[model samples]
Target: MIPSWQRSSQGVPRAEDEIASLKTQLSSISDLQSTRIGEAVAAARDEMAHGLAGRVSMVAELLTEIGGKPENSMLNLAEIQANLEFIGLLRGPEPPDLPTEIEALCERRRLIYDARDVFGDLFDRVREVLEIPEVSVTVVGTVVHDDEVDDETDEEL
Candidate 1:
């Protein structure tokens, strides 16, 4: 027959072990969520960049055709107008293929924000469960503006 304090002491170790396991699982899930968010943002930016590049190429071609055929000024004007319309379509309020990959990225970012908030709460809960004091995490970094500074110095000179 164990004393009451002994029984309580035995339960404390089991509780601590469970808390540690939960903390590990939460950390892993948070890391995975962060990685997915980063991937989604990268994919969206790439898609937008590619679309912009294609639009620029079309505009350049229109300009070249107009420059090459000065006599057909009316035709050139019509071509330019059509090209402009296309550009406007690309940037219009109602996109042809509405709710695109970039839109998905926006949704993913919101989910990431929510997940981060939950992660923070779980971190706090873990600390409480393990009887650990709260701690603040800090990150420090430096930004080097060598190119900008050099350009400014050259302009001054």
Candidate 2:
């Protein structure tokens, strides 16, 4: 067996080296977490883009159907309301006290408002994560508006 002092001398350096390696690993993990958070923010922005596209498509379809034939506008409104429900923006059936068509349209508007609120909150969160000095979140807001315009143009075409 090795002498105790020699054994200790040999082990001390190895243990110190191991600790240093562990510290390096921890620092790497911290970097990875930061990267992941950035990726999540980008992903949230993409999701918001897709959601906005979907909402715009539903709105355009509703408008087109309404313009094409006034008599069947109620059906189009119901379809728009259904799309809103599919997206988790609206809840429950149309109230019996209100006319079905008007109620459906009202619900669609309410759902749009809710979706706007959700996107706004998400934008704020992503902005918080970015937190780049001197960078304004207004640019992000502008991009979102431009995306909406593109979607609207596509619908018009």
Candidate 3:
């Protein structure tokens, strides 16, 4: 049997090369998506804190830590976003052991799953306190800066 190089047309790249290129492009797309989603969530959190719950000490505390990992990672949105992006970088080779990033992969998965429970519980609590109708997480990204959560709060009042 002829080798792939001998049988194939001259100058055409191999399947492996194309796969590697596509993987990098995919990773880049994931990074951008993670960043956009993270920022949108953070902005909504900010609006909820400063706009409607200005006097609620508990909500105010959540706001202060939502943008960062807080001393104890109470509502670690920042870590969740970083984990989301890190998940994108886990592209493995065909049957790849991927030892270099395996430790990181494990750690991030654990953190993200833990954050899910904390985030969901906190989010529900916030909604209960704000007394707002159900809102989709996806819808928040569509809101431009000017049309913030506060806009709806203002209209309600």
Using lDDT, give the best candidate's number. 3
Q: What is the lDDT of residue 69 in candidate 3?
A: 35
Residue 111 local lDDT, model 2: 68
Between 1 and 3, whose lDDT is larger? 3
After superposition, candidate 3 runs with Cα above 4 Å error = 1-55, 68-104, 136-157
Candidate 2's TM-score reads: 0.34
lDDT minimum window of 10 residues, candidate 1 = 66-75
lDDT (10s digit) by residue, model 2, range 25-79 = 9999999999999999999999999987876666565455335433334445756
Model 3 accuracy (lDDT, Cα) = 0.67
In order of listing, the candidates' clash counts read 0, 0, 0
Most accurate candidate by TM-score: 1
Q: List runs of model 1 lying over 4 Å from the truth.
A: 1-12, 68-157
lDDT (tens digit, per residue) of candidate 3 on 1-157: 4467743376455665678889999999999999999999999999977866564876766556455434235435656765675566655344434575567667776876777677667766766666768967687766445645776989999
Give the Cα RMSD of candidate 1: 26.1
The lDDT-based order of candidates, best leading, equals 3, 1, 2
Candidates 1 and 3 compared: the better one by TM-score is: 1
